[model samples]
Target chain A: MSWRDGIVLSLRSVVRRPARTALTIAAVALGTGLLVALASIAVIAETRVIAQLGKGGPATAITVDANVVDPAQIDSDTPRLGTAKPINAETLRSVKQLPHVSTVTTVQSQDVYVLPPPIGSALSGYTGDDPDRGLARPYSDSAIGIDFKQANNLPITVLAGRLPAEGSTSEVAVTLGYFDHVHLDPNKPAAVLGQVIEIGSPQVSPDGQTIRGRWSRGVIIGVVAQDLGSGGLVTSSTLTNAQRAWQLAGGDGNSFGLPLPASTYSSLVVVADSLDTIHTVRSEITALGFATTAPEHLIASVQRYLQVVDMVLGAIGVIALLIAALGITNALLAAVRERRREIGVLKAIGAHDRDVLRWFLVEALICGVSGGLIGTAFGIATIAVVSHIVNDYLVSQGLLGVDLGGAPVATSLIGVAGAAVLALIAAAWPALRAARLPAREAVGAL
Target chain B: MLGSDAVARGVAVSVRGLQHEYGRGRHAVPVLRGLDFDIEAGSHVALQGPSGAGKSTLLSLLGGLEPIREGEIWIGETRLRGLRRGELAEYRSRVIGFVFQHFGLLDVLTARENVMLALSLAGIPLQQRMRRADEILDDVGLTDRAGHRPQQLSGGEQQRVAIARALSSRPHLLLADEPTGNLDEESAERVLDVLERLRVDNGCTLVVVTHNPMVAARATHRLHLREGRLAPELVGEPA
Candidate 1:
């Protein structure tokens, strides 16, 4: 018969026994739905984590450091030193003029002690300025003195207030942690936008006498934005102002300027032309005798963990699908036994064995596809619900400082396809058996 | 009384020293022994026998649905015993049509669609099937019942649908196994009438297996099966 006729006949055959058809479909749907659900969630989790890791990281920037290094490696042994040699500013100017070298930000870091807690909670040394507060620190990881004009070029997302003006010597944009520590209300404009933080020197001079250093000036030009992450801060201030204060305290103030001969940054941060440039730029930087840090590595580790999670979850989903498949096969086998007479009748009236085969397959396919579609939605809903709980927990813990990750569309599609393929595979044997029975004998069987 | 116009122009079917047995070894049941017969190009014949006399088995052999244990069956020069299942299926689709006692219509299909299936398997083009199916159903006096599934129709209507299906592809031979056995007297009469009409209109060679004397009486030739062998053939007028 023509394909249309075969399909129509198969459809009618299914309709004739509604109860049987429904049971079969339900079995397939359960399997397909469960599979889709797990797969979709896994996909979403992967995409979210990857996106968070900077899937769209920089492409073509070079990183220069004190030593030759593999940019991709995160040295567990090396300490996160507060003080590091700055990449020479003069070299940076020369590098900027290099073809394909678009932009560069010289990063200088030094360990600084700040009391954390309420601004005035404990005068016990520096309570609120606890260095262990992680990214919740009220200052940069190491105190970084930047030329406010050029420092704005660093990849800092200012949450509240505007960028410090290029020539503004008094203004500063603190990391989100500093903003939180300052207890600046986000609803209102940065009330501390133009306020100053006084930096006092504590060390004595080489002359062996306590030196009264002039307090450094800093304007609260910007507040750090909250991201769903644990810790880290990015802040900027005028290099000249910071240098002058350090010099007044008999410290190395010119370290903020062009580094001395043979000097290179202990750590370098480079910006790519676009999101696609992230990896390439990171690599190029690493190739330039500098170590590099990519959120991708962190993201990759998270993804590996998530992949295991998904595999376990997906296995559970597959088990459900397996059960559903068995159910369909069992149901169909039962129907085959019951409908021996019906099969015989069709065969007698010019229905080929293949026609019978097609009928059973069509039934199973319907069950699978429907279940897959429904299950995809089910999976997405599940992720959404769980994500909501995660988001709530984060908010409650006040830990929504950096984004962890999210679900995407590709994951759902994979889930649905996987479910469908499984269902079809499950139904194959039963359909064939039903088709190959001897017409006369099967009819007589009834 | 076999008419040239009733059969296709070639030797339609021949059976020689045919033997058939069921099961094997200790459980073997021999159904036919040295059975021999030749049906010409155009003829309507009836096989009459008591239950277990192997009437159905003989029909199965002739229809190429079963293989003879010994001897040979030739339908239009193709040997039934040597053909593979796929070849047999192709052969059945192109060369033979069948009607069973119980009407054997798929309950899910409307009368017309049941016939359409036969046409489809015969490889008729899609555009031609609808009109062709409708014509056959109308010819069987099932025009009004074309939209009704088998379950919705009476036994006679179902039989008529089966007959329509058998004739839809215009096969050279029509095989009926107790075609009217499941019907009431009136319904059986209607079915038999339809079969007779089909023979005249389509000029098809017809072979029917039945125990009913009335059915045998209606055939141009009557062959009796007793212990799996045909009795001397009897020629008769339409009952």
Candidate 2:
């Protein structure tokens, strides 16, 4: 008999036995729905994390920390604090010469107050003499230090006037946030160019390890783009003079109660020529006793973790499906036994054993497909309800991520197909038994 | 083995020294002890026997449903003993049709579907099945009851449906076992009438296992099975 005939025969049987078919479908649906729901959650989680990590920062930008050792632990050599080798001019020089290191700039912070702090300024609501107190300063907010001679090392884009010319120690640049700190309109960065500004002395330590000096003056020759993190104090080409002025203002190595072996950078921002070179460059920098971090690297780590969880969850779903397949086997074997006479009639009427097998397998196939579709719809609906509950919870808790929908169609389809294939496998033995049924006994069976 | 006489005038079904047993090893019980028999082509033959006399076994052997463990069963020029399982199935589907005593109709299928299924099993093309099924249903006077399932039809009508299914493919050999045993007297006569008339019209050989004398009376020839051996055949005109 043709497979179509077999399928039609199988369909008639399915229609005849509604309760049995419904129970089989329900078993399959339970497994498939569980799988789809778990898979959708995984998809949403992955999408959320990836989107979060993909911010304005490009993946090619690697931030190199001065310390490789974990800061959360204290070493015996430093009784009270964790310590690691610092990034200095020597290491910076070596990094700049590395292959594919397109650009590298060291950022340093300045803790100084503008004399007669401007009114309604960052110095607002504070009366403390200690610079480290809640009292805020203009340059304290945007640590300014860059090698203005190199285009790649410019801490900020020159918004008006110009960056300091090479070897020009008297000229300085400030960020838009510095203007905000001084209570000046941020839009007026250009108006302050060429105006002389005095930086007050930083507070000295009680241990006499630091010495306070008189205020230092520099001409603001340039304004840089961005709200913060542009150079607020000095230029790298004129490093010694700037350091001498900062030291005179009591901003020496021992000023902040932390002993520095030498002048150290706060951090280094390294830019690779392209995405392909970023990893190698980061690894090379890390080998030099510095911690390396990049947006793409963090994303890769999260993805690795998420993949394991997805596999684990998917495996649980598969186990459920396997159990469902067992149900199929049980139901179909019973069918074969109960329908022995029917089988006999078919054979007596000239039906081949293979035709009998095909009919039973077609019945199983129907259950698998119908159950899979219903389960998928159920899963999508479950995801919707789950998303609503979860998103509502998140909103109440004031967390990121808006609405969670989009249940990866391709993965769901593959899962449904897999379940159906498994059902076919489960039905094979029963189908074979039916197909090999003897016409003699089957025809005579009551 | 067949005698030299089989070449002289061929028979529709020829059996010689056939031996069949059931179970296996210690539990194996012999059912049909050496039996030899023949039925003419285009004739209706009734196989009358006591219960457990191996009448159905003999019919199954002749129709190639069971393997010939000892002797030979020949349908036309083909030997049933040496045929492979697949070949035997083909032989049964193409060369022979069977009607069981219980009116072995698929309960899930309608009367027309039952007959159509038989035609399908006989390897009829898909396009001709509907017309062929309708023709067979009409022949059995089941045209109005074609849409009724086995449970919905009376025993007489169900038996006619089974008979229609057996004849639908027009197999060269028809082997029926107690086809009308479950039906009443009136239904039994109608079933016998259809079998006998279709037997001559289709020109296919027919052999039936039956306990009813009335069933045996409709056959052109008669044979009795006693103690797993066939009695001498009796010649008669179907009445």
Candidate 3:
């Protein structure tokens, strides 16, 4: 028989028993829908996490800190009371000369007292010589000093305005965490732009009995998202100038009661030539008597965990599909049993065994195709709704919302094709049974 | 009214020492044991017998519904023995047609679709099979009931639809096993008349398995069976 004829016969047979056919298709649709949704969700999750890590820095970037006596305190931003090999200018030049070391930027961190902008003022928050009396509030925060020209190499996400311009000692950029500290609205970061704030450096009296603040005033030019390290960003020159003023005001200088050395920096951010050389470069830096940390190791660990999640989700989908396949086999078997005489009639009308087999297989294929398409649509809709709900929750928790993109086309195709192949397999035994039935016995003429 | 040149000449049937049995080994019970007979081409033969006379068994072997176990049976130039499963199916489709007592019409199909199904199975194209199905339905006086399913049609109409299906492929040999067995008297008469008219008009060989005297009398010749073999006195006699 021709394939067209076989399809017609099978379609008629399927339509003849609508209830049974619908139920079988529903089972397959549910299985396919669940598989598509779970697989798409896993893919979207991996993309979002990788995107988040990408915002921090390239995998080739590594952080180098002083070799502290306490290993547990390594990479910590807080000052420790231990003699350590400081990351000085000489160390920076040596690391820059090492193989695979592309670039190095020095970083300095220090505690500062910040006075907030006035309630209603122009760009300059100063009302008179006493800018503290015109402030809305006061907050204590740490200031991170780095080369403004190398700011792009560090992990900084600017939400609004621009970063401190190169070599602008009076300019600074606050972090989103700064909003909570100084009672500013983080949702509208632009409102805080162009507002002036004061960074105070403490100085000791001659008798070493009292301390006073020697403040350096600057304007906020931008807002940034927090990264692995704490504190807002300022130019290294600005920090040096503030310390010089405090020292000139009779400060005790360094904690060791010695002159503040311009050669020493708290840490160094080292960039490797490529991701492949990050390990080698970090080891070389450690050999230079420093502790190094690479974000690639953390990213790799996160990817491994996501892979496990993806496998678990995929297995769940496969299990559901297998159960649906069994349902198809059972339904087709019952159809064969009920249509024994009909099969005999077809055979007696001169249908070959393969023709009979094709007829039943076509019926199964129809159900599978229909179910697969419907399931793919369902899965896409589910992903959209789930993404929306999750984004709402994230926004409510004061975190940036994420967008889970559409379902992958290759995944949908695989799901539909898998369903078709499985349906054909499920119908094979029953179709064979129908084809092998004796025409005489089935027609009841024996 | 049906016009198709696919089967222009009727096929003559010859059976020689044909032996068929049920089961295997010691549990075997023989049917159509060593039966030998011949029906001329285009001749209408009535096959009559009492219960357990193996008349249906003979008809089945003749129709290629069952395997020929011992001896050979020939239809035209093709021998039944040693034919593969696919070849036998082809023979059944192209060389012969069968009308069963139960009508054997699929309930899901309309009367016209039932007829078109046979032509479709014979590898006829879609438009041609549809045209042939309508023509055969008209020949059986079921043109108006073409759209009706089996449940909607009476027993006689259903049997006539079966006849239309049997003749859709224009087979050279037509086999009827109690075609009017389930019909009322008037329905049976109408069904018999349609069968006889189609047989004559198409010039195809007709073999009817029946116990009714009226059915036997209408045939050009009659054969009666007793037990597993043909009765001596009723062999090859004019009805």
Best by DockQ: 3
Leading candidate by lDDT: 3
Which stretches of model 2 miss by more than 4 angstroms?
A51-297, A392-398, A402-404, B1-8, B232-239
- Tell me how each candidate scores on DockQ against the true complex: 0.31, 0.40, 0.41
Better of 1 and 3 by DockQ: 3
Candidate 2, residues A1-446: lDDT per residue as tens digits? 87767887899888787898899999988888888888887886676435322321223356665666343421211122225557788889988888878778666544455542322233334443445654433333223555554433332445566777766655666655556554556554566666666564454545546545346565777765521133455444454335534544443345464332243665677776654566677768766766655656555677789999899987998888888899899999989888887887677666777788889888999999888888888888888898888865643332332446657787679667866887799999999999998877654642
lDDT of 1 by residue, A213-255 (tens): 4334555667543221122323343443354345345533233
Q: What TM-score results for chain B in every one of the models?
A: 0.91, 0.92, 0.94
Tell me how candidate 2 scores on lDDT.
Answer: 0.71
Candidate 1's DockQ is 0.31
All candidates: TM-score: 0.71, 0.67, 0.72
Tens digits of lDDT, candidate 3, B97-175: 8898999998888999888888888989989998999999999999999999999999999999999998889888899
Q: What digit string (tens of lDDT, one per residue) describes model 3 on residues A1-446?
A: 78877887889888988999898888888888889899988887776545432432333367776654345644433324245567777888899899977778777766567776663245343443245564456666667777777765675556678778766768888877766655556787787888788877666676565667778777888876634256664545566456645645664545524333333576788777655566678768766767666666566677788899999999999998888788788989999888887887787789889988998899999888887888788888888898989876654444544556778888789778878887898889998988887666534732
Task: Give each model's whole-structure lDDT.
Answer: 0.63, 0.71, 0.77
Q: Weakest 10 consecutive residues, lDDT, candidate 1 chain B? A: B1-10
